[model samples]
Target chain A: MTVTTPRGFRAAGVAAGLKSSGKPDVALVVNDGPSDVAAAVFTTNRCKANPVLWSEQVMADRSARAVVLNSGGANCYTGPAGFQTTHASAELVAQQLGFGAIDVVVCSTGLIGETLDRDALNAGIEAAAAKLSADGGVSAAEAIMTTDTHSKQVVREGRGYTIGGMAKGAGMLAPALATMLVVVTTDAAIDAETADRALRTATRETFDRLDSDGCMSTNDTVLLMCSGASGETPDADEFTSLLTEACHDLAQQLLRDAEGSEHDIEIQVVNAATEDDALVVGRAIARSNLFKTAVYGKDPNWGRILAAVGTTDAVFEPSALDVAFNGVWICRGGEPGEPRDTVDLSGREVTVTVDLKAGRQSATIWTNDLTHAYVHENSAYST
Target chain B: MTVTTPRGFRAAGVAAGLKSSGKPDVALVVNDGPSDVAAAVFTTNRCKANPVLWSEQVMADRSARAVVLNSGGANCYTGPAGFQTTHASAELVAQQLGFGAIDVVVCSTGLIGETLDRDALNAGIEAAAAKLSADGGVSAAEAIMTTDTHSKQVVREGRGYTIGGMAKGAGMLAPALATMLVVVTTDAAIDAETADRALRTATRETFDRLDSDGCMSTNDTVLLMCSGASGETPDADEFTSLLTEACHDLAQQLLRDAEGSEHDIEIQVVNAATEDDALVVGRAIARSNLFKTAVYGKDPNWGRILAAVGTTDAVFEPSALDVAFNGVWICRGGEPGEPRDTVDLSGREVTVTVDLKAGRQSATIWTNDLTHAYVHENSAYST
Candidate 1:
């Protein structure tokens, strides 16, 4: 029954009273043996949450024994009072779990600027500690979610190594709501620098390409910990591959969980003059609300697509352009190709291919369709 | 009673069978003059409408005597067939108005695709020709509106000179949703190059700065025509001032027309490292949906402001930042400064100031708040 994807680690999740829905909202995970070799990436947003700030400093030391995460409140922009609240929360978790306060990472997600009920957080931490078990990974994954309809978790085993991770976010997710927090545990006997490099490279391709509504969050981080329990350590290539698979698996899940989303868009740009130009055009279309909504309504409104790409200063020849939506050639050789009614859009996934017809460079961007659910979830959800 | 602020121009608007609502959706204005002077600019979007493509080529010859505009449909991306439709529309206007087809410019707003009713359009052209008058400017203004609750007309008169214009677009509009088409007529004598330079500079600062929601349309244009009938032309400096005044006036009208737009936002960036950086930062913040919705809710949420700014690579010390929402210093010197609840936000306009505190550079980006009406209008509308 143990769900521990990595050796030398145990985790737990418990009802923290932090979420008004009475759902499990607090999780604690630990590297029980050997040194907890870790490397972390933090959100680049200047307006950071207290947990991010605390974790940023602690992460500079490149090691951690435990991480405590709670959903339902993002203790951010609360100034000195909020930071102290974060410090106290971490201290309480570390004291209960027999880990040093500096070695304990803390995270909170939900409303911003609200004070954390210290009594409730304390009880939650104690309960999580008491409930810690090898089979508690799923419970921990269930706890750290906000506005997400499902849990996002990924596990991989390769080269005598195991990699497991969990993530949470839907909107306020751009390269850097890329404010995603993920916990990756491995017993691969890997070095901290290796883990950091693999994680950054994988994240740049996966999470960084998700431009859902183009809003960056203040509390985003991806923490990877290597317990170094496995005696067999793979080479750089093998280790990087293992970490990338884990990151990719989680990235797809994040796209699937996009709030009230019906369509997942994968925009591929090919034959561009440069990779930079391809991405510029791809992201421009991905960030376009009109284009997303048009696709949502099953309207092959290719004009909006052309209009979006046209706004960019990139060197694209309108006459040389060819565009296809959902495999239907809408625009070819710079003119209308066929009626949109002929385009089949019964699939949940849509592929928009743009041939810049320039010099063969290419890139892809992923996003979700704009829907009423997205607006409702963002506008009405008080959090 | 003469609303024609510019001398020597006969302007009028008449209903064409374009809008199903029975509202006036077509307008025509003639620059009858002792001197025919003209210059124009079109949307930078590469995927342009038929009118824009036709007019850009026409303006290269620097000659246009009368302009016809339709609001019920935008002839964009109709392909070669669409190109023929524009040609037919212009030929009829030219024949009836006693000018060559090259002398007449046509603009269409409303839905895209579908063909124009040729017979109705021909008749509408004749009707507008018969009704053309110097005193008919008001009715002409009324005829050009679509989704705009008011007719935007502005008259700027200086010492022996004048600049008058009519425009359409809601205040909270982005470049995409707002297919801004403006026609300005003046009695001042100026060269085509001068007119083009003045118009480009003025539009860059005035219309381009209004980058709310970052929506760029296929048929955005500003047409300037000089009749030179008053036989009085100002000095170079004086003419520039008159043009600025006219642009300022029209800009106000456009903002006033913004859809269900409750608050007008002016985001001023100062002390940036570079002008480009200033523009990039201002535009980034303006395009941010979360910050926009927060302003709509009157929350004065400064953290969202900082988060938006952080997404840009424009160099700034997060700890050295300062922000004021509606003139209230919410974040001072990079941390929460004072409670912004005391700030008055009931006014129709709001200004957010961000100081990079890096160098001597500043810019102001005008935008509109994200209201429920905006969502409703954009969502419910079929086009």
Candidate 2:
């Protein structure tokens, strides 16, 4: 998924050999045109990784010349040395491309704390710069994945404009702004402030709402760059809509790739007094281990749902609450609703709806069920 | 344990056939004390269980004439009727024992949201009254367990008195308190206010520090009922010391009984700016699934510990942190420590020390590891 593959801006992805597997691990996407608009959202974790730290400082400037990502190291908890290594990494790419270091954004994913191979990193930077092309976006997407089973790339074209993005995360990963590193390049001309506003708004409804394992990571980042190469700038409202659609596509891809996930479980909260209440209730159910376990076992356990919701501070009359699993109301008003035998759970996607019946607010959170494979995979691997 | 087993009271554990396993499920304890002395602590979960609601309200009277507990059904989220069931249950026990209804406290645990069988419960009440004995603590203890592998009970003899208690929880039960129901009976005399203060302080060091699974329960309650029958009214200070010791013993037992737990992990966060910061750091590590998984595998993965701590807003510099897993300094100043082979994790308990070069405050949280058996046990059973 390249910017030029969409409509106006050209994109590129290349094999920079940053990973020990000799896989394409370094990716760079450059926006070419007069209007070089950009915005970014980094992880909210206080103890951010080196790449995130660098991107955070640069994101304040509201413009990005390049997005440089490596797949084999997270560069977290490596102390001051890690930050310097990250800075040098960006410098390698920026100097090669004749761009300032500060205009370049950096990202990494893999084992944390270990020092990166400076020579290999610099070599990869040279290769990436030389391999840069509008058609390299797909290769760039493949280079950023760590445990993800597949590459996630999406492109949607509109009237003389385009939105294309690539994301990578198998979701032991959590982020306040986004789950993983997603770079969305657009030929749709938009202001940096508009991109930031639309990205934040779309993210809360998209990436942020997907709560795979509830374990927030230190290196999650999402960068959006806009180039006016299309020579056609749309209204801010249209750009926001296009951004939302792109975010929705990437969000779906992240959920689909959640590690060891079998069923994609969604908890939809409706009729709450506020979106915060819906989120509180949704998050309460999303983080519930018992509830997740039941879903993994393919059991319509509505009791745990009620119990989890009751644990939250959201005010609601127990008698007015209702819960449904797979469209069948298993519990209503704190009493038995439909029979359990009628509810099916063998599907790949399950929906658990909790109606507050208190007001008119709603939200949705995507998650996965607890499974034996999840335990087997995660228990053996150290964080 | 029951009050009647301690010299001035009668107790009974009878079969209402409430548990699917056909284990004795209904228990009653009565206090025929010449002096009433009592105190209690309820769950911190805002959406409390039915028993929590009843117990908190009754213990506020500073006197408990009787307590009726039924397993196999946690009368929670049963709405107004669930509240009414507790009232009716207490009324039944109170009527049978000729004790005032307000003097009776009620507790129920098992599956959440299930209604109690009032008729069966009433019959068990009569049977328990008939079978009341002065040494029925073990039977009562066994009847209260849900998934606990064994009943936890402890006894300590004091000067001219004794402190005996029983608890039911399998560590995964986070007492928000996790499904905890504790009953401590003593013959020493202490006023209600003194007992409450001592109980709170003791819990803060003991029950409140156990975070095994970090999933807060809505039905946790701890009740202390003193008969004052020994005619040995100790001073406030002496009474508090004995209570504290007894609490320590019981709390340790629960930690050891954590379900599917091969290693009982004790995480101590020390040298902090405040006790609250210590607790925050302790809990962040305690709740980390990756850290717990490493503990289960005996891998001494210290990076997970650093990753977890750094996620918190607590004022601990990454370079100023040191971590010891089972006495092996795996990380110092947020970097690799002395190289050492793996520790023998076959032992029943594991200890982790996270030293923050900050202040003098610290906290300890007891937890179990994430094992394959845990996933199997939880996933196989639906609530």
Count of backbone clashes, every candidate in sequence: 11, 8
Docking class of 2: medium
For candidate 2, the per-residue lDDT at A375 reads 64
Q: Assess every candidate by TM-score.
A: 0.90, 0.95
The residue-by-residue lDDT of candidate 1 on B1-383, one tens digit each, is 22356777776777778888977877788888777778787888888888889888778778688888888777776677777877887898888777788888888787654556666666777888888888878877788788888888888886786788888776543323578888888888877777877887778778888875677888888898888876786776777667777877788778766877788889999999998788889998998876776676676767677888888888787767889987778887666776767767778899999999989989888888776666556644554
Model 1: native contacts recovered, as a fraction: 0.37
Residue-wise C-alpha lDDT for candidate 1, range A300-321, written one tens digit per residue: 7676778888888777877677
DockQ values of all predictions: 0.42, 0.50
